[model samples]
Target: MKVTLPDGTELQLEEGATGGDAALAIGEGLARAALAVSVNGELRDLARPLPDGAQLSIITGKSPEALELIRHDTAHVLAAAVMELWPGVKISIGPAIENGFYYDFDFPEDAEVSDADFERIETKMREHVKAKESFTRQDISVQEAIEKFKTENQDYKVELIEDLITNEGAETVSLYTNGPFTDLCRGPHATDTGKIKAFKLTSIAGAYWRGDAKRQMLTRIYGTAFLSKEDLAEHLHMIEEAKKRDHRRLGKQLDLFHFSEISPGSPFWHPNGMKIWNSLHELWTEQNARRGYNRVKTPILLDVDLWKISGHWDKYRDNMYFTDIEDRPMGIKPMNCPAHIQIYKSERRSYRDLPIRYSEDGLVHRHEPSGTLHGLMRVRHITQDDAHIFCTEEQIQDEVIQCLRFGFYIYEIFGFEPKLELSTRPEQRVGDDATWDRAEAALENALQAEGLEYELNPGDGAFYGPKIDLHMKDSLGRSWQLGTVQLDFSMPERFELAYTGDDNDEHRPVMIHRALFGSFERFIGILIEHYGGEFPLWLAPVQAKIIPVSDLFNDYADQVAQTLVDAGLRPDVDARTESVGKKIREAELSKAPVMLVVGAEERDAGTVSVRRRHNAGDDDAKLTIGELVDVLSAEVAERRRPDAG
Candidate 1:
């Protein structure tokens, strides 16, 4: 049989030879480093036989696919160790997640396991890695596989097999065995346990089986693995830094916002939080206005029939909050696009108004499971910086480019470098293939026209359209999806949105859904962590704090505060009658960007001593009140970052 390598080189091998054989045929070193193989773009186990003329790429530790495989193999080792330590532990499923892996297990009632048990489990995992247990795969009839697990009291495995047979029409199931433990899986794991070099069990939590709240609760153990010790150490350090910069903790310490039992996943924004929100809103408004976007407001609750017309009733009802209002079924909107469509259709439009942009800081609601909700990142109530552009088909590419540019501009102001991704249609979308092809092509062409590089995210688009998604990397090197521009043909067709053509004939319009800051709540959460709560002057709730050296200087502090307030900046007078040292310490702790100390000398000089939080610079630099206001105002006007001079 012949196989093609990634570099277009052809390799000849005997029939029925496996990927491991091909790797050895290429070189001895490759075979030793090979973890798996990608055959014709599909990942396969090294022991799996290669087909004739298949394109094969050997995966080594340096390959991007290696971490997932290593993490998955580490999970298998974890399950093996758990089963050995606690006999008769029923394992449900284990898979690699972002940066790590987790396995769900139904432990016996007599067993007591927690994070405290992580050390012993990790010790056993090290033993497995040291033993160099080879991962062996076997395919068996569904009945035989079920019987094998049933005899071991693995009911979860039996249920999984039954579902696969019923839903996917499977005739056989694959099983992988490493040393004393075997699991039902379709795997492309590392060649052996020894390939897992550096790993650590992170934590444990209770999770519902299959994420169904009604199903049996299982104990889930999370762990991360890396191919080298240095990588693992770097990742562990990032984890510690992430904990210190957690948005939830910062939110409380900064008195930004808080979640309460009165409103489960909704935030009660404090004054400080509102200040940040208003600053963002001002930016959002100014950008939209400059781009010719018409701001509009939409109702939160609308009749269910409206949703049915938009296909949200069929496609997104599960995630929506619905109510019976006046005996009419109503849905609390999970999105603003549908309502924007109605506004476009409210009156007749012409080709002259081909691109009618409607922007909204729309409040929306969605049904989120209590367990899945995080501080502000994942919430039931949301405030979307949403917009819809109703444009002619001929205008799609340019409008999409404009949206891309708009998103890039907003992210730049926050010091984020965004990466672009073109997401294609999903399997369960509403649009036809031809329409989908056009939408996807338009987006790709726009990116190409702008000379912007993007990744292909397959089958992850919105239900109505293909989209260009912008994922920004924060200061901590963590990526977050912050913006999206979706090109939709289905919704306009569904709503029968039309405009008069130049020839006076009616023509269908294309709908582009865009949001730069995906949601105010989530964006703020990211900002909190991105800046480590030391916000820039423009976005900081308290731009400057005025501290008096003594009670005699309190009057000067209040006068300086009034001057700052008149200059359109948020300033607070620290007249608590405390010592100057304590006031300075408290101001720094509050993450105030600037501190102004007014003493008798400064009062007579008509100047204030300035201190910067984190001492970025300018400690004890005295400036007159006018000079101080001018500098602070310029920083706020330019939206300068705290770290930037």
Candidate 2:
């Protein structure tokens, strides 16, 4: 049989030939470098038999999919090492994740494992790699696979095979073996353990099996792999930088917020954190007004019937919080769109009011899993900078362009350049194919009209519509999805929303759901890390720290703080009766954007010496009270970053 290569060249091979055989047919060098083969765009193990007349592309170290395969192969090496080090350890599933891979294991009660064992595990992994153990794949009957694991006391593998057969109606399962370790996996791994050139076991944590809270907790080991040691070193350096800039640590150091057992995923915002929230809130309000949006608020809880009509009951009910109110089921709103739709339907609107824009800084609650919650990044309680636009189909392009520009404008203020992604309709959605096609086309046209380049993210849209998602990388080079503009034709139809057209007939108004800042909680977390707790003047909780040289100048510092307050600047007087030098050190540690040092000389001169944190060029410029306030207010008004210059 003959198979087509990526370059459209055909290669003849034996009937039982595998991807390995095809690569060797192409060239010896390619066969040696081949990690796997992409059979008809799907990755297949090199040892797997190649299909006749299939298009095959060699997956080498340079391929985008290489890292995932490397990490996954490394995970097998890790499991093999751990089981060797500690006998009787039961292994669960292991898969490659973003940035790395992790394997969950049910450690024996007598065994204690931690990151301290990483060195030994890595040593054993290297030995396996040095052995050049080729990954051998075998297909076995489901019952035989179950029996194999059951006899080995690997209950997890037994359970998995049973699920595949009972739930998925599977009759066969695949297993991969390297050296003496075997795992039940549907895999497309590297040819051998030797392919994992550089790897490190990064961390260890506890995770409930399959993310179910009721299940037994398993020990999870995370590690990353790269083709070269240089790439691994760079990634390790970034990981170290990320640790120093972790928002949770900064939040505590800066007195921003804290999580409590009383409310698992809810944040108890400190006064300092509230300052950041208010700053973003103020901007959200001002921008909405400039864009002709009417700000509104809605109830947090609504009847589940509303969700059923919105199709979220069927699609998103698993992630929602539900309660009983007056014997009727109520769902805490996970999103504001359904509630906003009700407001749109309340009044009879006209084509003149077609582009009715409603903006809400609304609080929403979701039933997030306990393990998935991160300090502020992932929370059960959230405040969304959400807005919905009701407009005619003809107005879609302009309205969408406005939204795109609005998102860019907001992100640019924080020194972020967001990349756009056009996400199309999902398989499980509420609308007809024709409506979804129109919605997707409208979004794509808007993006083209704006002259913006975007990546096509297929089947990742909301259940109601297709959307344009904005993802931005932060200072640490980590990308995050923050803004979205979704176009929906289904919601209006489902809710029976209408506006009278010029023809004196009612027509369904298209709904455009948009948000520049996805959620206050998550955005603040990103900002905390982005700025490294050294916020700009406008967002800084304590914009200026007023330090008096001694108790003699305390009164002057108080007066200065008051003047700053009257000028709409946040200032705090550091009057601890400490030395001026000590006070300055503490102020710097606090990350105050500006420090106003008041001494006898400045007091006599009726001015304050200005000291900018993190700025080495310090002449300690003296300015009068009036001059100081003007400069600070100007910077705050402009929302200038300390490093913008």
Candidate 3:
């Protein structure tokens, strides 16, 4: 049979030859380095038979797809090592995630494994790699696979095999063996365990089976792998830096917010935290008002019929909270669009009134799993910077570009260079073909008009719309999906929303739902980590901390704080009866952008000594009250960061 390589090289091979045979036929060096084969653009195990007249490319350990395979293969090694160390440890599924892999297990009731066990497991994994174990793959009948796992008392494997057969109608399943270990997997792993050169087990946690709360909890072990040691070291360093910047820790240390057993996944903002919220809120409202956006407020609980008509009941009901209020089916809004639609339908509108922009800092609730909740990052309660633009079909492209630029402007202000994604129509979306086509095309065109590069995310659009997702990269180079500008044709049509056209005909308005700061809470979390809690003057909760040298200077500090307040600056007086140095230390720990030290000398001169938090080796500059206000207010008005302070 004949095969074509990625480089257009043709080779002849025997009928029963595998990818291994084809690589050898091409060249010895290629054959030696090949981890697997990409046949017709799909990865396949090297031991699998190659198809005739197919396109094949060799995959090495250094290839882009290598990380997933390496981590997955490392997971198998982990399981083997664990079972060897302690018998009767039933292993569940282990798969690669964004940057690593995790395996869940049902440990014996009397025994437990924790972080202490990671080193022992890693040592055994290295031994397996040192042995250069070559993976052997084989296919077994579905019933036989079930029986095999049943005999081993691995109930999770048995349940999975049964699901594969019953739900997917699969007749056979593949099993891969490396040394003395085997797993039921559809794999295109590295040819030998040695290919995974650098790896580490990072953490352990508890997870329910199949992510179902009703199911039994299992232990989950997470680990990451890389082809080279240098990459692994860099990754480890990032992890350490991320830990230091964790918002949950900083939130408490800086006295920003707190969570309670009284309300899980809901943050109770301290006065300090509310300061940060107010800062972002004021900025958002001022800028939006300048853009001709009108503010509106809607009820938090709406009748269920509104949700049903908006397709939320069908699509997002599981993530929603429903209740019966006064014998009427009511739901706490998971999103503001449906309620905004109600506002749009309140009265008749004219084509001249088209392009109506509605903005709100609205509170919403979603039933996020408790396990998935992480401080403000993934909260059940959210205050979203939500806006909906109702415009004519002719104005679709302009509105999209406007919202896209708005989101980018916010990111740019926050010092983030954003990555964009244009998500197209999904398979199960509402609306007609023409509408989807126009929505998708307008989004793509808007992105292109700005000379921005974006990824086409297929089949990931919202059910009622296609959208462009804006992702911001943080200080650690991790990308987060923060804001979206979605174009929808279904909502107006569903609710029969209309305006009198120029021709005097009732026509539906095009809806553009956008959220620049997706959730104020989540954005705060991102900002906390992005700026490493040393927020800029405009966003920092405590813009300035006024420290007095002794109780004698306390009255002067109070006067200074009041002057700052009257000047529209947020300043707090440290009135505690403590030493000046101790007060300065606490002020620094608070991460206030500036510290104003008031002593006898400053009190006599009617001035304050200014010290910037992020500046080093700079002596405190003595400035009169008027002089300080001129300098600080300019920096705060310009939203200058700490370095500028």
Selected candidate, larger TM-score, 2 vs 3: 3
Say which prediction, candidate 1 or candidate 3, comes out ahead on lDDT: 1
Ranking by TM-score: 3, 1, 2
Worst 10 residues of 2 by lDDT: 636-645
Model 3 spans with C-alpha error above 4 angstroms:
7-17, 21-32, 106-110, 140-173, 207-218, 313-330, 369-371, 614-616, 642-645
- The residue-by-residue lDDT of candidate 3 on 1-645, one tens digit each, is 989987798888999799999888878998888888889999988889988999988888767888898898988888888888879989899999989999898999987789998998999889998998988898999989999999999999999998998899999999989998889999977798988889999999999999998998999999999889999999999999899899999999889999997999999999988988998998899889988899999888999998998888988899999999889999999989888888888999999998999999989999999979999999999999999999988888888888887887788778787888888888888798898888888888888888889988999998888999998888799989999898888888889999999999999999999998899999999999988888998888888899998899999999999998999988999999998889888888889889999999999999999998856479999999999988888887787755432
The C-alpha RMSD in Å for every predicted model, in order, reads 3.1, 3.3, 2.9
Clashing pairs in 3: none
Error of 3 at 67 (Å): 0.5
**Best by the lDDT measure:** 1
Which prediction has the highest TM-score against the true structure?
3
Candidate 1 — worst ten consecutive residues by lDDT sum? 611-620
- Per-prediction TM-score: 0.90, 0.89, 0.91
